[model samples]
Target: MTAATFQWLTLVTLTALTFSVAETGLSGSSILIPVLLATLLKGRLVIDRFMALQGVSGPWRWVVLGWLLLVLGLIAYTFLYS
Candidate 1:
């Protein structure tokens, strides 16, 4: 209901998803999608909620978002290629 409650729930859901993915012992592309989705969702939550950047907009927000995307993209690329 409340914002804090929703945020906490989101975090818990993300954690559960991550744990489930790890427990499944999936290989190849099957592993990448769920893991990456969970990771990106978690990163966005931390950046927008915990970092308190959901409302304001500026270069800092762009920088943080860009960094997250870049790192995640590199990770996905590495996983897929290697």
Candidate 2:
């Protein structure tokens, strides 16, 4: 399958997962795991596919991945600690 098609499917799946999380009445802390995982997956997909970073080399790719990790880490920290 094409990368775009795969990304689109992942997005749809993430949306459904979000809806399921909301409908299940789970606690906020418990819900953070899947939410964070989906966020990371989506970020990676966008970086590699849409941003065309898959074929590139060097520190730039790591920089973008690190940025994504940092943002997601902060989000998880706040979600868990607040």
Candidate 3:
């Protein structure tokens, strides 16, 4: 299969994994970290693949990826602390 097709499948798997973990009704950082990590991967896939930023140079991809990391890190921090 093509790279785009592979990315698409990986994205779908990550999404489903996130949902499955959520539906487990479990709690704590152990579960939270993996879910967040999966979300991070999914976001990167969407950014690089679907958004078509894989080949571009400069800071655009970094900018978007940084934004995603910041948001998700904040989320993890918030949940872990509170």
The number of the candidate with the highest TM-score is: 1
Give the CA lDDT, 0 to 100, for residue 42 in model 1.
86
lDDT for each of the candidates? 0.87, 0.87, 0.91
Model 3, clash count?
0
Candidate ranking under lDDT, highest first, comes to: 3, 2, 1
- Write one digit per residue (lDDT tens) for candidate 3, span 52-80: 88889999999999999999999999998
lDDT value for candidate 2?
Answer: 0.87
Give the CA lDDT, 0 to 100, for residue 74 in model 3: 93
Q: Candidate 1 lDDT, tens digit per residue, 1-82?
A: 9887898899999899888888988878898988888888888988888898877867887789899999999999999999
Q: What's the ranking of the predictions by TM-score, best on top?
A: 1, 3, 2
Q: How high is the lDDT of residue 31 in model 2?
A: 90
Clashing pairs in 1: none
Between candidates 1 and 2, the one scoring higher on lDDT is 2
TM-score for all models, in order of appearance? 0.90, 0.83, 0.88
